[model samples]
Target: MTESGRKLILSYYVSIDGKSVGPTNGMRGVMESIDDEAQEDEYVRQLWEAGAFLMGRASYDAMKGFWPVAEHPSAAPMNAIPKVVFSRTLDSVEEWGASSIASGDLAEEIARLKAEPGKDLFAIAGDSFQRALIAAGVVDEYRLWVLPAAAGTGTALFPEQDGPLRLR
Candidate 1:
C-alpha cells in the first residue's frame, strides 16, 4: 500500500463470445499437457512475474478451490502471491499464503495499491470486475484476444444501462 493508495491493475483471459457465455467452452483447450510440462511452466513463470493480482469473490472461490493443490510449479507461487478478493460475504479468505479482503471503497483501495511501489498489479477476472472498473473510469488499457469463431449466445460484456461508449 502507498500513502495515496495502491495501483490497481486488472487482467483477464476472455474470448470473443462476450464473457460468461464462452469463457469455459474449452475453445482454447490446454496449452500445456502433462507430458509437455515446460509450456505450462513458462506460462506460470510469466504470471508470477506479473506481481500482485485482484479478483472478484466468485472468481476467488473458483481459483482457491483449483490452484492450491495444482501440480504446476507456478501454481504454488501464484497461489502464494498477494491477492485481494472483492466480496461482501467473504469476511476473509481462508486459503492462505498472502491474501487480504479489500477494505474501504473499491476504487480507493485500488488507488492506494497503485500508489505503492511494486512490479504491476493485475485484475484477474472477467465481466463484473471489468465493468465496475470501466464504469469507474479506472482502467488504463485493455487487450482483447480475438478467436477464430464466435458463439451466438451467452453472456455479453457490454455495460448495463443507457450510455454511450465512444471508442477511438
Candidate 2:
C-alpha cells in the first residue's frame, strides 16, 4: 500500500504498440510466447499481497472458467483471494468461492472497498472496464507489463481521453 492508504492498482499486459490485446493472432498465441519467469514470479507476489481482486463482468466470466481448473503457480493465490465483480446483470456469483457481486455506483463501490482494512485492491479487467475506472479517476496506481512485441491492430490499453494524465 502507498502512503495515502490502500490503493486501487490496475494491472495489465500490453504490447510495445500500446495494445493490451495480444498479437494479431490472439491472446493464447501471445501468452504462450511469453518466457519471463522473473516477471511471472513478481506477478504472483503481487497477487499474494492483494487484499482482494476487482474485475468487471466479462473478466469475471472469463476467469471463472479458467482459474478454478488451472494448475499453475498463480492459481493458489488467484483462488484464495476474495473477489468482487462489478456487474448489474450478474444475479449471482456463488460458483466462484469467496466472491461477490457489486452492482452499485462504480466509484462508490470502489470507495467502500478502499475504506475496508486490508492491503491494496487490485483490478484485473479489460479496457472497457478500465476506461470507466479511468474516467472516474479512482485508480491510484497502474502496473503495466510492457511486453516485448507489437500487437499490430488490437484494443488499446488506454482509451482516448480529452486530457493528459499526470503520474508520479
Best by lDDT: 2
lDDT of 2 by residue, 1-168 (tens): 655468899988777787876435365477667888998899899889899999999989988878989998889988999999999999998877799999999999988888888989999766788878888989998888777777777787565756776667
Superposing all C-alpha atoms, what RMSD in Å does each candidate have to the true structure? 4.7, 2.1
Candidate 2 wrongly placed segments (more than 4 Å): 1-4, 22-27, 161-168
Give candidate 1 misplaced runs (Cα > 4 Å): 1-7, 17-45, 159-168
All candidates' TM-scores?
Answer: 0.71, 0.90
Local accuracy of candidate 1 as per-residue lDDT tens digits, 1-168 = 333444444444444654433345554442121345654566566567556777778878878877887886767767878887777778889785677887567777777667777766777665677678767766654544344345444455563747765444
lDDT for model 2: 0.84
Give the true-structure RMSD of model 2.
Answer: 2.1
As a TM-score, model 1 comes out at 0.71
Quality of model 1 by C-alpha lDDT: 0.63
Which candidate tops TM-score? 2
